[model samples]
Target: MLTTILNLLEVAAWSGIAALGFGILFNIPKSVIFTVFMLGFTAGLIKFSLMYFNVHIVLATFIAVFFVGIICMPVAHKIHHPPVVFCIPPTIPMIPGYFAYETVLSVMNFIFMEDDQAKRVELIDTIFTNGFTMIFILISIAAGISLPMLLLRKDSVKKIEE
Candidate 1:
């Protein structure tokens, strides 16, 4: 129980760091900092939970992105500008950088270790498959959130013109 709480705290800390960093960089208002923090916190929770089940990082990224995007949609709507910027900063917690770096290292090791062709092949294959999955998740999140908003804006413009 203690360990779980500690782990949760750690997740919160990292999420806050990511959120605060982006918020400051983008000049988001101090009043909205908590909102960004929570967005990042939820993304971290989703990523960590999926990672616990040994779900591929790509799938995990997708889940985090989709969940955060939906949760922030109403907030985004209220902003009346490029609300996707909010989601982009908040999604930083779901980048899976560690997994990606490890995957790259494993590939490099496999290439240099000339004795085991089979292991090399396996490493390379996992890199491609898992990498593809991760990329797809990131793209899906961006597309899923942005496309609807874009279309809505276009329709509003058409109505104004008419």
Candidate 2:
């Protein structure tokens, strides 16, 4: 129970930091929820494989997804005209930095190991896991954010036509 509580606290702190950083980077001032959601997503990405704390993963993911939805609101406003035109600010905070780092470290280990084939193989496997996981996360997050907006826009258009 104590460990779970600590992890929740950690997730909150990290999420806040991430959201603030992203908001500042993108010049979006006074975005409290944005900061929280971005940070929460990062936390979810980090704890994806933890078997003991699956609940945290779900909560963090929903929180992050909610913020991502909020962020997309303004994006939808800007790209309201040309559906193909999408504007992404620099500090969106969707990229998973830790996963990238892990991937790089794994690859480096594989390359630097002189004689341990097993270690190299293990590192290689981890590298693939990290890379694919990041890719999957990115695709899923994008889709998760985009799909709703797209559906709404389409429905609005249809309503107008009708």
> Which candidate achieves the best TM-score against the true structure?
1
RMSD list, candidates in order: 4.5, 6.5
Alpha-carbon deviation at 16 in model 2, angstroms? 2.1
Query: Each model's TM-score, in the order given?
Result: 0.68, 0.59
Q: Write the per-residue lDDT of candidate 1 for residues 1-105, one digit (tens) a residue.
A: 789767966886698689769878988866677777877887777777787789876667677777765666566555543455567777766665665776777
Cα-lDDT of candidate 1: 0.69
lDDT for position 36 in model 1: 79
Tens-place lDDT digits, model 2, residues 94-119: 46678889998888777775468777
Taking all chains together, the TM-score of candidate 1 against the true structure is 0.68
Off by over 4 Å in 2: 29-63, 70-94, 154-162
Clashes by residue pair, model 1: none
